[model samples]
Target: MIHSLDPAPSAQAAMLDGATPLTQLGVIRVEGEDAAAFLHGQLTQDFSLLGLSEARLAAFCSAKGRMLASFVGFKRAHDDILLVCNRDLLAPTLKRLSMFVLRAKARLSDASENFQVFGLAGGGVPAALPTAVWSQWRDGQVSVVRLPAAPGAVRALWVAPVGAAAPTATALAEPLWQWLEVQSGVAMLSQPVVESFVPQMLNYESVGGVNFKKGCYPGQEVVARSQFRGTLKRRAYVVHAEGALVAGQDVFSEGDPDQPCGTVVEVAPHPVQGFDAIVSLQTSAAAAGGLRAGSVSGPHLTLLPLPYSLLEDI
Candidate 1:
């Protein structure tokens, strides 16, 4: 079962209760007659089956099956698809993605400057917002996707042209929205952690980020091997620590100082206290005695509950 964030009502209460510009995320637009066909062959998701009302969480992988970037993708039209991902990763990802376009009729370009993205939460959100996770709906000028939220908390993503007006009753601080994202246990891609994990290590497959049934992409063989052969040894987990936590930092288990047990994937200040983060580590190490962030003597860390269950038997 997925766990709820912060037992405190006030912390859980801060989600998209207002509008906040998501300045950290960047957008990529792929258009032309071959957009769908091209993406189907390049990413883990089945773009051929994508519907205008649905969004997909997918990963772009290296030939060895390590994730290069992850994206929340949706189609604005039959020939127009947009991918939203971290701003720091967009430029390099776009360049790498373009290399595979060869002679395809598709066109890929950074659309971050042309569009504005916002995070929206609370009862004040428009009544028409999509309610299911990854579900999307678009009007002539705006598009919204419902993001995963704790029980009783409502959250959504708002995307529109750069000059469009804000889409909520009021504005929320950026730090608050980022904190909410960490509590939700869905970490976005960024530079430090690039090429560091297989999709499963970050729980991407469990969260609808990987499509195993789709035909071969760059690392299909390795990904499928990990899933079917039970070779997955590390998995993402939520944890709390007292000091600053940085992504891609090493995690050490008290029982074994000789080897690092995990790597921090994402982190943010806790809305109520301390700091919380998403760490991908060895399943066995997670059960071992004490855990430390950064170095063997680094800040002590306490494991928190993950919002979703891992597919252990697979």
Candidate 2:
């Protein structure tokens, strides 16, 4: 459904070409015999489903079932799995993952700089991928087709080895990626916000980030409870703030100073307008509308519909 936005080959290539590789993003490689087995039991998604040409979105959580980080997980080879997350969480996350691989036949290493990550908006990909890939699409083929975040904002990826030549495209800055994240409703986990959310609170299941049927992970119990128990008090939603927003900032309802009704998950300057953010809040506070942080008179926030829907049952 996604086609190349450029009518001209040169224009398209120019949009694709760049001195600083526009397609390549920071990456980390986790390789070892036990890589898949180890990750299968540690992440929110099913690692057994990963393939050389496929990708997934998964979460790292604390043993108590609190979300520590979220990532675009994919496989480069039978032994290599890639975890793409926020730059700020790289070192610590890598260190943490490495800690658990002591005896397992797995090796975790940071590969952020070795590969380039690009966002190809619109459809120009060949038909070798999923017709509807809602999450990360890690491909290395020429003119590869990738799934988009949404129908309106079709995005593909073109990743290559370091020093790889680009296809000659305008080098849009990284902010564009962040903008897409906000608009697409992809809530990323950041440093101060680690261990703050369970997968359900962020709509991870609907987005293909959580696999309920999968064996088990750190926060499996709590996450399962939040879903099957029908006791989910919090859910992530798109929101906007009049003032600068920070992740982990408390969100209040009716200006009440009680247990924060919610917390900011992700925020970014709108590409063409005001600011945009994702907030996870208690379902009760969400129905009432008006929510603020520091003070009722301070920053007022407006709620926006998420790109995807939360399943009714769970």
Candidate 3:
């Protein structure tokens, strides 16, 4: 059985109210008449029909169907869309996406400097905000996107021009926001694990990141086959370890220490002690338990219940 741990009292209280600057994230702005169509053809989600009030959690994948980057994207106007992703991967991701723009009339640019991003949790969330995950609310120059919440905490992404007034809530430590991110069970793509997975492996399909009905994209065929043919053998799960864990670390199963069974996708210090991570593991290995992080003799890991349900293979 999976074991769950309670947050430390101090941590729980801190999570109840605060906002943290998301210095680790960056923004990509896509503008022009063909922006939506261009992105629709290259990403895992359908941007062609995106509505201003809705945000999409999408993936950009390589031709082999390995995800290169994941994004929280929303339309700012009919021809303008903003994609928020890991700052470390923004330059390359933007360059790759731009390569396909060719004569499509779409323009992709790094707009990180033009905007500020913050993570709002619990009481830090603005009084008036969208309650549904992936929904967006805009007031003049500021935009707020509701994110999947962590247990006991409501979360949202706050974005605005670089010098805009910050959220009024108490300042939250970045480490706490990092912990809540892992607690949310949604792993954002980063340089360390780029091309390490397809969207489904991270439960992106279940979290509204993939659109199977959409037309062709870089890895659309492979992604579809994995879904319809039931060929997906790995999935992301939350795991806790008494020792620190880092992204890109390998995980092993005690039953078969000779072979690695998983890869750590994201990790953060646990609110109480040790660390928590989102790791993608072979489904069979995950069921077998006895997982260890870093190496065969590394720290023991305890499986934690996923915050959300995995959709049955469609």
Candidate 4:
């Protein structure tokens, strides 16, 4: 059954201050003169024109247009770029990315061990940090990238060398950080859902994750077709339910019980009660209501408002 629930006031208060180590994330470093150019040719964003003071949300896709990984990428220097992604996907993503390096003068390596990653929220975020989403601010060896704020809270990604001092704020639990991530409405790609979606299925194009004018990447043709042909039948939506939800789990709608109408992209326990998740659902099913998680007769899911507006289809 589809329904609406009041926002959790306490959860909003909790999001107002805290810092948490983002151990689930890992870093992939690409260095050398061709780093940006090489990545620009391979991913869904325009890395070749990427500025030093900006970070991009991008995706790596299979030729069939399924996302294998997603990244919050930025240039640390003219020749050094960093891709922050789920730790579980780092090794294989690095290997797959390296395959086409051929003579690009770029080097890819797992640099997770060389850095510390943290998620900062509200007052826990440095006062001087850039306020614009995707903008980057750096101080010596540390870098902070402003992320899209969740309801009632500002957020940023703090990355620094391993020995740098941690942010001095009330320690936020990793679970809270995960919940804020879901609240932000941007789902990061992880191992369980690898190859499960195309970039647009998750609204990547609307969120600065795709550059349609860029030159060809692996799935460029299919992605462009989905946009221009008006053939995209599925889209990501935020949802809530009174039960546990898992990534890659199937979502069913009473309108069509023979097969799943959606897939759970990411989920987290809601601070107040139950769970919140980002789900990619067939447009028709999303409109028909009666969404269930896991199985056809599983817990009912209620649609929630997305934090950001989706771009109009071109």
* Deviation in Å, model 2, residue 78 alpha carbon: 1.3
Model 2, 1-314: lDDT tens digits are 11232125445333432222333235667888888889998899888767766777889999888888787777777888777777888887788877777689988887777766566553334334466674334444332325336324455666655676654544555655565566577687888788888888888877778888999888799888888996678888887665788778888887466657888888877544456778888988999877986556548888776777677544
- Model 4: how far residue 179 lies from native, Å: 0.9
Candidate 4: worst 10 consecutive residues by lDDT? 1-10
Error (Å) of candidate 1 at residue 171 is: 1.3
Tens digits of per-residue lDDT, candidate 3, 1-314, equal 12345656566766557899999999999999999999999999999999989899999999999999999999889999999999999999999998899899998999999999999998888778868899999988888999998877889999898888888889988988988889789999999999999888999888899999989999999899888896579999988899989999999999999989999999998766799899999999999999999888998888888888888834
Model 1 over residues 31-132: C-alpha lDDT tens digits? 999999899998988898999999988899999999999998988889999999999999999999999999999999999999999887776456786677
Q: Write the per-residue lDDT of candidate 4 for residues 155-240, one digit (tens) a residue.
A: 89999989999988898878878877887889999998999998989999888899999999999999999888976799999999
Provide TM-scores for the models: 0.94, 0.84, 0.96, 0.96
In candidate 2, stretches whose alpha carbon ends up further than 4 angstroms from where it belongs are: 1-25, 123-129, 134-151
Root-mean-square deviation per candidate: 2.3, 5.1, 1.9, 2.2
TM-score of 4: 0.96
**Candidate numbers sorted by lDDT from highest down:** 3, 4, 1, 2
- Ordered by TM-score, highest first, the candidates read 3, 4, 1, 2
Q: Give the winner by TM-score: 1 or 2.
A: 1
| Candidate 3 or 2, higher lDDT | 3
